[model samples]
Target: VSQWLKMKGKDPSIVPLLHPPSKEKENVSQLTLEPIYSSFNDWATQFFEEKANGYLACKLCPPSSRTVYGPKTNPSNRSSHVIDKHNLEPPPYLRNRKRVREVKKQKQQTLAETPIFATTEREKQRENIVIVYATNLLSASTLDDPLWRATFGEKLAGMYPQLLKEMTIEYSKNLDKVFFSRAFGPCCLMADGGKDISKHKLLGSCIKANGKIHVHELFNTENEVLDTTWYQKYFSRVITDIESRSNLVVVGITTDNEKSVVAGLKKVVKTNDHLIRIACGPHTMELFLDDLAKNYKPLSEAIKQARNFCVYVRNHKQPLSALKKYQVDVNGNPVKNPLTLVLSNNTRKWSGGFLMISRILRLRSECERLLRNFPDVPRLSWSSLEDARDYLFEFYLQEQILQRDSSNLIHYAFCWRQMGRHKDSIVESLKATNHDTNVLAISQCFVKHQEKMEACRVFDLCCLLWPVPPKTNNHSYFVNATAQLHYLVLRQWKFYQDHADALQLPEEYRGTNENLRLTFLNKAKGQLTMHYEAVELEWRDPQHLFQASQEITEGHLRQTLQPTPNLSVPGISVEDYWRSVACLCPELRFVVRILLACSASEACVERIFSDEGNIHDKIHNRLDPAYSESQVKIKGNFLVERERKLREKDFGFEELEWEEE
Candidate 1:
């Protein structure tokens, strides 16, 4: 070939190397000797150069096997096969470039059969951005501005309504899943009413049994007062509607102590005995604080002085800024105040009295100095401040304790016990401050709280059943516990029996007699016994948990009485701890699940009211009340669902111990 090229007057170097077909077959073994390309550029150039002769190679593939792939020209197809078949990350640039080319090619084909105005990829992406931005900020109309068109183009900017509709539909579907799924099932109902920016009445319900916001609706009462009758009928209707839609029973309803709401709740309970009626524990505590303050002269005088002092600072920004500056100067932290006075207001959820007292006590020295610095500041008598803190410190702490995780069921039994202790503390205070006018008022409120706590036999029963900080499973404890459990079961039985009698169901199915009561009690005791045993055994040997024998009760009792903290227990949450130990005590799983679903207070619903104010603020004021409801519901439930997903991913639901024979 070189001799022929020389005779033709062309340089021999210009001639392309051409291997004979027979020689190519001989050289196939040598072709497999090339090293694997580290990147796309090397692989693409080398492969295509070789492909000029209609050959394909895969250096990474075993040479003993077919180390070659295809005469594949499509980079995407080649990269995809390499990744799938060889389990490798294909080069990014080549894969992305190939993907973009394929997409454009498909787009061209699509455009050929469509109108010229068909939305392009860039327009679709811009439309998606606008939709997401609008949905997040609740600012749908912002996209309608002419300024947005310059950046997003008219076609994309104009699609905001469609984008919003799609988002609403997606959000609705998610909410539907939350409502219908067992994961969000059988929740406590927390409902409250608040006005929006336009003073439009909004009533929202948060189902905390499964830690998901199930319903948040706006009531179009149209400038009318929501009286007792309205609340009664509305609550019943809402509960029924939610139950029907979600297929999840409302275990209980919690509300603040408005006389109308209290009376309305009574009506709800009258119709549904299965539904427990609970006054918001936090709200009740707030009332207790108010009653104490009213009855106690010194405390009332102290609060009056504190309120005036706060008013002077708050209404005057200069004084407030001076106070903050004093806090920073004294503490050596300019950016953060050691403590900023939180003005106590009647409307605050955690009573303003508690906040005022807590802050005053914490920063008593600084506050006194600040008062002196600002001569205009109201002089709170030192005796008044000291006397009020002395009298109200216990009450403040109790209120704070009850308010803790008010939306969590795990703390309900604990809160109930704490309330009893608080009553005792109040009684002690009543005696200590015998001359104070507030003593009688505090005593009266304490008596009422004591009676309420005492009436709920189930609260005591739940306390007996709680797993952590183990109880002595003694003969006396068991006997008393059994009696309490029996009382609760019988009450539940009577409730169901009355319902059956009222409905007059088929005679065979309606049999709710002493036998049914006995059966329930027996099951309850058995489950409790097994649960106690399982919890004890779990600490000893979790691996062989199911093998734990009930006959080893005495040994289990001793262990439970003196639970040793291991490396795992401290980090584990109450839910996770129960979830872990539940398998060993399988019969008690459902009982624990129910207890966990209960909320101590209706704070979750109250949180929605605050959220609604933010969502329907001036910038987002045009949001329809219904739309606002949807947004808040999705926001709250999405957070809970996300946590649930992460928990499930880490420690799955499949670990639940099922009931054994």
Candidate 2:
């Protein structure tokens, strides 16, 4: 006890008093102990019962347990033992003691400091309100409206007009800090141009990083000529800026296949050998739909008549009322919500045309009844409308699938393959019906765009990487794919070798000796062949045993398959499949990352342009370019972060076999 007191920085001389000498204890008789015993008796009685033998037993413990205290024992000692051994609270009378009160006061103070009950900080609440306004495309002046003040009070109402702009600027700076802190990998650039409601020509650019698309920039291009030369210089400047700012490697550029844009990308590709130019898949499909509407005489006439009928129904109330009445029965009960005639927007792609045709077809019977009373209404061509709807329906579905931000080269190739099958079926049916002209037109249109899409060598390489076998029976296609894969692997390997010291290449990857280099190259080739065979086998009959031409054993395949149990399963995405198999295919993993990261469509940029239109509408026409850009950045990045967190929550984190250097 003396040593413990000394170690605790206390006076050791006081230790002897803790266990008083017997002479001092004897001096304290029953008369002196009586007062102390009497004072604790009341408090102790609540938890302990006194027996006839002058011993106290605890009531809380089990009856069989040996817990008894003698009468001569100090009441303080008995109380301390009971409280410490059983983890019990002090008696009610002891609650007012000074020490207990001090402890309770300390606890109250700590609870007061916790943030659980605290309100949001004023500045944070302000920023959140600004984000909500920007994301919903609300006018900045709405912040100061009377309704806002009544709902949120004066402090949070943001009465100042410039508050939105100021808050957006601050948020954008924070986003820049976050973006610059991460190590960038291979990414693609998507750029497009559009006009706002006020006729302000705007160009938007976005970058796909780590499979998430982020808006990079949006600015007015009214001052500059949007020619091929201008576009080339603009792309060069953008690429240089992106590379200078981060480690992102621009592997490809995707844009709509407008004449100027295509010519500009071609020039950019010629100068930058590493970059590939891709035509937007959704845009190409849209053009095909437009062709059907324009070139086919019967379809064109039906669309014209359908559009005229919609305009008439919307303008004249009598026919509209009649249509609504037809929507109900004699009892005037509505089975469903009354759907009005929908007008097609020239700007939007397949949706407008498809919706217009479908609505007209659904209301065909009602319209035929109304025509007897209203002769001015256009005559119905039910057969022509049905054909147009059927043709446009396929492209509409394709457009919806291709416009997804997650859609990569693999999805592009797969969707087009499905479209080709659809076209073939349509052609066969048309042949049976003796509609030779329609058959020829559909075949030629599909082949023309498909050939253009396949012109980019990256598509073929991605298709090869895809687990499913290519749709073609041609052996030459696979041969070319193998050759291209070899070239890509060798190129990546040489790059690693060149930067071996900087990359801190692992022993397996660093081919320092000539023989080591040759061996690695041979192994890469063998692995590629084995992968191709495995893919074919899985596609044809998953249960079939795969036999590699080289020394690869069943154990090796098992090891590769162990990590990716779903690799052979349908509905797995290309990005997921490549990531799962990355560790087993080290050399090809680098190529996969670079090639798969290249987007086949500029749909992301087009969507951003649509958002821009909403932001720059007539009500918010005076929004400055910087303010608009900041709003777009905040809205885009905010949504991306939200979606990422949701994905992580829904399907835990995906294990990546290799991370980019």
Candidate 3:
């Protein structure tokens, strides 16, 4: 090949290309010459040459600063040295190479146009998966799981933070539209706090408006000391912010019987005269039970014995097994999943003390049989347990009634009166049984708490507006409550009337209509006075009240005071009743709406905290506090809307009775 190339007057280097070595020999030759060929090719060959020792020395570089590439060095090293040292343009082939960024852009565009990478449906699926993950408390890392990836595809995985942000914004907007509508009116603020499994102290707040409770804000108060001053300041700011954001007027605040919270609320009420502070009725009743257990020796001893018995059975496997084995029905058939003893914890609001006693009472036969083998267990005082159980059962019913979201001051008053009657009956029963000390102690406890509850003027006023006349025989108390009701109604009416009148007139004409407004106000007062007289008269006579329903006629006083059907039924809604009568008594309806909207207990806020605990559980302990709170708020508002929709869908018919008077 070299001899032929010489005859043709061409360089001998072309001889290798024209007559390449055989396949085996060519592989070896290419491997040996690859480094030399690559280093000298294109741009590098312009300014460098390979030496005997297999180094490519740069020609353009100064002698002292000459750069070289070893045999094992990459071709990029030679090319970089030539271009950088000489500041010369790269060869055509090198210059035409695609850049890293342009290559990446092309790949992305190609992928975007692919069928699998289509976004519309995939994006929706991803959004739904994120919502399910959030609402169901699924772990964010589950997105990366092998099974999840295989089922949902790899495209749906990751991006948790970004997806969560979008969902949070969307749910926040939904919550705003649902809970904070422009028709916002009077609402009560409820606040409570507790520690989650993570030991993070959380304070939750809720607003009750239009007979539904809406979660407002949740704060991580781990660093703040929970004291009267802190609560006062915190609640004050919350109230101010809420009022500023909407047309809602916070007419009252309800909270559990925490000393600092109560003291703080008192301070808030002092500053804001229109606001009333209500102690949670259920919490108060729990305290009442606490008092009874402390003051009554017999009841206290019985409860302690019952608690010890429960602990013994639960801790000792032998007794528990025996009790379960012996558990049977009245027909002597074996039962599956036998009842277990419920241990009472003081930290829990329900106390479960009554539940504990009740369980033991239920498994009495089984317990008695188990006691034969396990004599070391403490014996229960059956009579004393029965007495305590029966007494606490009444309070239990009252607590359940009061804890309802629909419960209001009127319900509180009725429960209070019912408890008073139950207490008296127990005292009389104890007197007949010759238990003098027990009777005296029970009487004192009832009177003390009763006085405390009645001290709040709002309770009495709400009771006076109860659809059914209060069953008290104390005519003097009734007279005083009636007077207070009239005064409160008139005051609220004036405020509402003045606000309405001002809004109706222009700013320039408001001052000039003062005389005309006074005249209108006087006429309205006369009508309100007549309605008050009719309400009071009907309240004193139940027969007359029901009879007046039959005499309804236009422009008649009976029409104004017509008794609503099923008004005394326990299931009847006070808010609904007042709404039914709104046309007949707008002033009365206005006052009742505000009072009824004031929650009687902080159960709704307690429920919010419970949900937060579930969301921020051990598995999700590392969740961001703000994220967890948003989840709880969104979940709660969704439930509220769902319940409202359900209530709207529920319809019923009732038979109406009329009397020919």
Native-vs-model 1 lDDT? 0.47
Tens digits of per-residue lDDT, candidate 2, 242-311, equal: 8888876676687877899889878887787556666665566566666755555665666677777777
Please tell me which predicted candidate would have the highest TM-score against the true structure. 1
Scored against the true structure, residue 311 in model 1 reaches a CA lDDT of: 67
- State the lDDT at 150 in candidate 2: 25
TM-score of each: 0.47, 0.45, 0.45
Residue pairs clashing, model 2: none
Instruction: List lDDT for all candidates, in order.
Output: 0.47, 0.51, 0.51
Clashes found in each candidate (C-alpha, N, C closer than 3 A): 5, 0, 0
List candidate 1 segments past 4 Å from native. Answer: 1-174, 181-185, 328-331, 334-337, 341-350, 395-399, 402-419, 422-434, 453-661
Number of the candidate with higher TM-score, 1 or 2:
1
lDDT of 3 by residue, 345-390 (tens): 3213334455566677877877788778788988877898888666
Q: For model 1, name the residue pairs that clash.
A: 295-437, 295-438, 296-438, 409-598, 583-657
Ordering by lDDT: 3, 2, 1
For every candidate in turn, the CA RMSD to the true structure comes to: 25.8, 28.6, 23.0
Off by over 4 Å in 3: 1-178, 181-183, 312-327, 330-351, 373-376, 390-416, 428-441, 451-548, 551-661
